[model samples]
Target: MDKIIYAILISNDRQDELTRLLSGIRGISDSNLFNITYNDISVVASDFSSNKIIVDKEFAIDYARVIEDLAQHFTLLPVRFGTLMESPDAINEILIKYYDEFKQNLQKVENKYEFSLKVLWDYEKCSGKIRLKTESEDQNAAKLFHNNSVSTEYLLKKIKEHRFESALLEHVEQLIGEISTRLAQLNPIHKFQKMVTPNIILDAVFLLEKHKKDEFIQAIDHLKSQHDDLNFLLTGPWPPYNFVEITLK
Candidate 1:
């Protein structure tokens, strides 16, 4: 039977306590949970038949639940779902090989959690507003080239389209800058994606100290109040999923 790896955590010489905790929580397929240790770090795992696994919503949820439960008690690096080792010896070898990398990551995430924020707006309405502003500020290109040939008219249309796109991108960038500036006080490690969808203008994740969770939420609320035209959806205090950068071999 293969062992399904859930997370790597700092045991800190608490093996007996960890064993008691794992005894109360079940792994996928109700398998017993156990840990394979290397010095002060450990990998929480369970016996699993690789062939018996089914990739489905239920399985994914169960897997996440296990990690979430462990996270409440320990600082852990969540292994990718479905990670399996052929035997305990192989698992031990991995723990040995990646020990330094694992320790570094674990220390970085200790006492921290992650949060996500999505800024959304009505794309059509926002674009229309920008178009109106652009046209009002500059003479209509179609009117300026009314007497020109068809080729000239097409070129003018393209130019207008380009200007509109540029303006929209500038607007999004300004918003991102403002968000970063406002949240800088919290000193979170953050990642931002612009224009995740037509409506979702910004998608961001932040790794913050656990003690700062409330202040972070308050900061987001303050930002939301300032942007009446934008919708801010902020979630979490979850395990530092986005902050983990290690790739296990």
Candidate 2:
């Protein structure tokens, strides 16, 4: 049987306490959860028969819930869904091998919680406005294409559209800058993905100190007030899923 790993946690000198905590929470397939420890760190895992494991959305969520519960009291690196090993000794070998890196990462996230922010806008409305602005700015662009061959006209149109798209991206970057500026006071470690979709202009995640969560929410609420044209969807105080920087081979 393979054991599915949920998280890597710092048990410190609290193995007994960690044991008590695991006793109360069930893992995937309602299996009893337990820890395999080496020194100060441990792996939360449950018995999972590889042939019987169902890789489905429900099971994935159950896996995350187990990690979520562990993260409530321990600073942990959540294991990716479907991670499995043959034995506790194998798990112990990994912990011994990666002890320093794991300890460093645990220190990095010691008291921090992760939050996500997505900025959305009306695609048609925003693009329409941008097109108008681009046209107004480039009124003389049409004159440069006076030859008027079909190919020339087509290329010119594409150029203008490219300019409009570039302008929209610049606008999004500007909004990101504003958000970063507002969040500078809180000093979070963040990552961003711009224009993930036509309507989703900004997808961002932040790792902030746990005690600063309320202030972070208030900051986002204030930011929402400033940008009437965009919708801000902020989620979490979640485990630092997006911020995990390690991969166990």
lDDT of each: 0.90, 0.91
Error at 139, model 2, angstroms: 2.9
Question: How displaced is residue 220 in candidate 1, in Å?
Answer: 0.3
Model 2 / residue 245 / CA error / Å = 1.3
Roughly what TM-score does model 2 have, to 2 decimal places?
0.97
| Residue pairs of candidate 1 with colliding backbone atoms | none
State TM-scores per candidate.
0.94, 0.97
* RMSD (CA, Å), each prediction: 1.8, 1.1
Q: On residues 13-69, what C-alpha lDDT tens digit does candidate 2 reach at each position?
A: 999999999999999989999898888999999999967776899998999999999
Candidate 2, overall lDDT?
A: 0.91
* 122-191: candidate 1 lDDT, tens digit per residue: 9999989998877754466666665778888788878788888889999989988998999999999999
lDDT of 1 at 91: 92
lDDT of 1 at 57: 94
Error of 2 at 105 (Å): 0.8
